[model samples]
Target chain A: MPHERVIRHGRVEPDAWRFVGLDEGEDLQALPHGAIVVPLAVWKARRDALLARLEPLGVWLEPHDEPGEIAADLPRLALVAVRFPKFTDGRGYSTASLLRRRYRYAGELRAFGDIGRDQLFYLARVGFDSYRLPEHRDPEAALAAFGDFSLRYQGSVDDPVPLFRKRAAVEVRHG
Target chain B: MYRYDEHDRKIIAERVAQFRDQTRRFLAGELSEDEFRPLRLQNGLYIQRHAPMYRIAVPYGVLGSRQLRKLAAITRRYDRSYGHFTTRHNLQLNWPRLEDIPDILAELAEVEMHSVQTSGNDVRNITTDHFAGIAADEIADPRPYAEIVRQWASFHPEFAYLPRKFKIAVNASAEDRTVLKLHDIGLELRRNDAGELGFRVHAGGGMGRTPILAEVIRDFVPWRHVLTYCESILRVYNRYGRRDNIWKARIKILVKTLGVEEFRARVEEDWAELQDSQNVITDAEYARVAAHFAPPAYEPPSDDDQAFAYAVASDRAFARWVGRNVHAHKRPGYAAVTLSLKRAGTPPGDITADEMDLVADLADRYGFGEVRVTHEQNLVLPDVRERDLHDLWQRIRGARLATPTVGLVGDIISCPGGDLCSLANAKTLPIAEALLQRFEDLDYQHDVGELDLNISGCMNSCGHHHVGHIGILGVDKNGSEWYQVTIGGRQGREAALGHVIGPSFAAAQMPEVVEKLIATYLEHRVDAERFVDTVERIGIAPFKTRVYGAGKELARAA
Candidate 1:
């Protein structure tokens, strides 16, 4: 097997889980023996059967799929992967925010597909903990992107306080 | 004149560093052209017809003398000896190299400016009334709110990769100087019955291939909830705005499809949830930004200067310039002066390195150490003292910046057309030059009286042809260029789009067609009615008849 690199919490690590049934006719039965991730439709169709297997399980979603579809299943999953399809297709960002902020999903969240070095900083800010860099790119070099900006002005999933509020707090403390 | 704090400084520095790496990667062939296009565009670098163009944001049209001087230095070093001031109140360097842009952005950060979000699918530079603080009829200063929104929209993680480019404009003056109704989101400051400040917001209006005026979605959103309200509107646009077709991707089409009432309902639902979030603007934060825009120190009003009165009486040129270029100020002893960029021979908003340096020096010497870029593509010395009018005029004339045609026929706003922009259908500068040559006599321009003529190379409306009193649009038929004329569009209180007069004309006949329209207006006016007013009253019938009826005469004249 080829070595797959996953960036989690700004560090490179091996990806333990395998994604299954990504293609239209891929078999859901007789899956790999280790950790496995299923598609959203497959998870909905064979929820109890997949749960009965007991090995680590996760679900992945397409860009247009609603995060609310997996809200009740959050507690049963070990990971949730959101596919970007294209870096410019930004509907996934809102989906990530809704999954983390509204649904309060605390498991590992990963971003896959068209994830470039330039997108890592913004992805991390909106609550994605793991990134599967495309195969041709260097995951080690892309790790530097997370530190690209030392400060951000607006609130995000990483930090809920905007810069102005923080500055105002500092002013009050000093006074 | 909003100064950068530690947070602002660090963010801009980091953005410069980030862009430097992106440029390096692209040059090394690691990033494809498709991948690099949006990244470079977000940093305000466009691959124009001749070379790379860099646009620098002049936030809310405000510029400090030091900042303007820095821009002059940048143009001198990184580009041709000049820059073009756009209708959106930003400055564009037409000939910068791709390798030199990161250095340019680093230099910009030293003066508290950046090209971030200047041109991209993300939020653009927030624009407001040029006379934001000094306008006599404003309910309250809009700069503080504009600053707040600017910070919120900067590098916003969720809205960064929007379906299409978005623009937001703020206005507080009674006259709507920023063309509020033509923006994706327009906020007008108002005071409720309880004397508390808030905004009357309009959403989903834009000008491009399709032009639609924005409808007021909310009558009142409290001051503290402005950020949340805007966030709600943006979220709705980002999630559902059409991504299938690039031409139909703007928020204007989305609003039109869903109907304004349904769009408002969806936005209200989002706002109701976000109102109590940490995104709310705190009182302390509002005070922090508002303090930066407070009234500047001014000496008390004194008796009118005798020399100014004498110069006005003796020199008709000086008197006419004052009548057209000077505007009333909220303070008694001060006045806002527009330094015209529309000289007879030059393209409308093009200013040279020497001109930029000279304007900075004048701003420092005659007024506060600040200047404004108006949406009309001119510069403003926002707080010039009335007592120094004569000396300022003489000094301004030394640079040929004193063109006494502020709103007259000679003052034409035009885009960088087929000459530079790859998207243009025809060349706009030659048409503008012909019009200027025909009206070269300043006496004739003044007699024409307060006519707004705007030209666009295409329907993208970068020159704002939709709102001009007499708008000219460039078109292409077969392989040759043609010009279409529209009359009666106006921008201020009751804004409306112009009506197309008839079929298009060749480039050579543009000047004659405009002259015939002007002749009709001159003949039909009662008292000193403006061209737009006359067109509105007599309608397009008589003007169309005059131009199309005398085709043989026009052919002979041509």
Candidate 2:
């Protein structure tokens, strides 16, 4: 359990990326140079200008945003954070999977907004390395949820090969 | 029943511990109702009218003797000495303290059972015909496939939360005993021209305020691709199923909006990618699961068992029971017996702890130590030898389970109405009792014959009133309990939703209204046509006219 720690893949690390929402309307250039995340629209509009800077860049994606556009910018962006407008809506999980698997974006992937602590295990399995738990929730207690289940049946972004294939591989190996 | 492997056991054990922590957080004032609602729902805990009702999924409704004993003990310890079997083929303990649920779930896990996804927005316990593996007409056993689906859907990362509660039912026989068209995903196992086992997949079927039957999404998907196909459908539903309005959030509404042709196209597109995934079922895996369900030992009888014939000939009551309760098995010497949980003067599926313990013992003695909970909320010994039928009947009779009303009028499917549920608009138990009283004559009920009478507390259709031959839906009119009756519904291969006869009637008038409909059916000149068939043949005109006698205000509410 990464108690009081932030997860980046299988390792625990201090969170470095700072979130900037769509409605915040802040000037992206004024934010901390390397740790800044602007909305997907802003990143799409000013991709060349943002990439010209001498620092790693980030873009935030919501469930409704076009994640396909990020494929070309995968090498440019250091962090990709997915936002869920509501806890009940799970489209962002799929969006994260596509970003990691289809787009092959291996940079830091984070989940924020309306994504509760209870969803951490699933989000982690689906290739989310970081989470910004809603303001009221405690991150320490939420860490226990990460190691709640050790086995997963289906393949996701983090583990492209599913458990059954691995199980069969082990059986063949031992034999 | 599929025996749990290390993978299965580990997952279930971890889930119990996870839920224990969740319950602690919920009680410690750390998790609000809003935050904990879905979490508690995933564990099958609901805060009903009187108290919390915890429902445990009886996966495919098959339980070993050990599991049955565990359930009996749980109910005996934590609840009102009994549990209610639901239409989804799950069990509900009516009066468990909120805090005791984690313990109940832990105990359930020890028995290789848990209530996970039983009452959540995710996929529910997969249901099938009680006589699934042993049915004479079945092409293949659907249990292995059902078990695969159950494991695949458990704790699904993407679909843990969906637009609404989803249900799936599997049927292998030509007969649709599980009400195939009335679930979110209905899988009917079949064989193609080349005699390869496949599935006829249907999606977007549900019954609530709006009841829409499923459309065939795939005519034939081979057994190897079942999980991948299911994933495609679910992922598409997760992507496009309505999330704005809870009332219209079911897959049925989505199919209605998108058109089945377009919906099928979307699922096919998803399936195109999923086919290459590791979700596919190989022969090795299928055989391992099939080994668990392979038939038990059987001893063949002579041309005719004189002892059995003598018992059936001598005991009139036993003969009647054999006719109604005994279903022919694929194995000639073995038969499946439906133990009626629909005894008169009690809520339809309420079986006491003592009754469960007795049934467990009965399963051990007569059955091959297996009991199946039917979607109709009855129990079955799926592999009872025909030679031991008389002896089994005697034990069941002693336990008040041999009701001789398996598919008869008295075998009513009902929901925990206003009596126990906060969501119920009216109480259905009292109404059930009144009907049972009016038709207590065993011979008279037998004469009525083959009536699928189902009653729901409201239009939620938990009792599956939509597919009943005689459907009763309770309504709230000016704080008074009223019921609307529907007729001409059937659940098998050619499933159809029942149509409302006319205006709703007061609770007092329900029994008489039903009696008038039955009288109309009796008076019609039909030779051996069942009640639903008669209603379908002649239309609802005759029955409606008799029930609303001379009242011009009546209009069909179909």
Best by TM-score: 1
lDDT of 1 by residue, B1-558 (tens): 689998899999999999998999999998999889989999998999999878999989999999999999999999988999999879998999999999999999999999999988999999999998999999999999999999999999988899999999999988899989999999989988888889999998888878889999998999899998998899888888998898899899999999999999989987887767788999999889999998889889878557777888998888988998888999987889999998867899999999999999999998889999988999999998887887899889878788889889887899988888888998999999999898989888888898889999998898899889889999888878888889998888688899988888888888888998999999999898999999999999999889888455444321
* Model 2 lDDT tens row, A1-175: 1133455564545667666555455665565555678788778777787778767678998777767888987888888988888887887877776787668788888888887678999998778988877657767667777899998877666665666676677778998
Residues A27-106 of candidate 1 have per-residue lDDT tens digits of: 77767777888889889998998999899999999888888999998999999999988899888888888888879999
User: In model 2 chain B, which range of ten residues has the least summed lDDT?
Assistant: B549-558
Candidate 1 ranges beyond 4 A from true positions: A1-3, A24-34, B550-558
Interface RMSD of each: 0.9, 1.6
- Residue pairs with colliding backbones in model 1 are none
DockQ of each: 0.75, 0.56
Q: Each model's TM-score?
A: 0.96, 0.95
- Please, what are the lDDT tens digits per residue for candidate 2 over residues B1-558? 788878888988899888888889889988888888899999999999889988999999898989999999999899988999999889998899999988998898888999999887998899998888888888888899888788888888878878899999999987889999999999989889999999999999999999989999999999999888988888778877888898899999999999999999989987887777777887777877889998887777567677888999999999999999999988877789999998776789999999999889988988778899988889998888888999889878977899899898899999989999988999999988898888888998888889999999997899888898999999888887878888988788889999988789877777888898999999993878899989988999999888887574333221
- lDDT for A88 (candidate 1): 94
In candidate 2, position A71 carries an lDDT of: 90
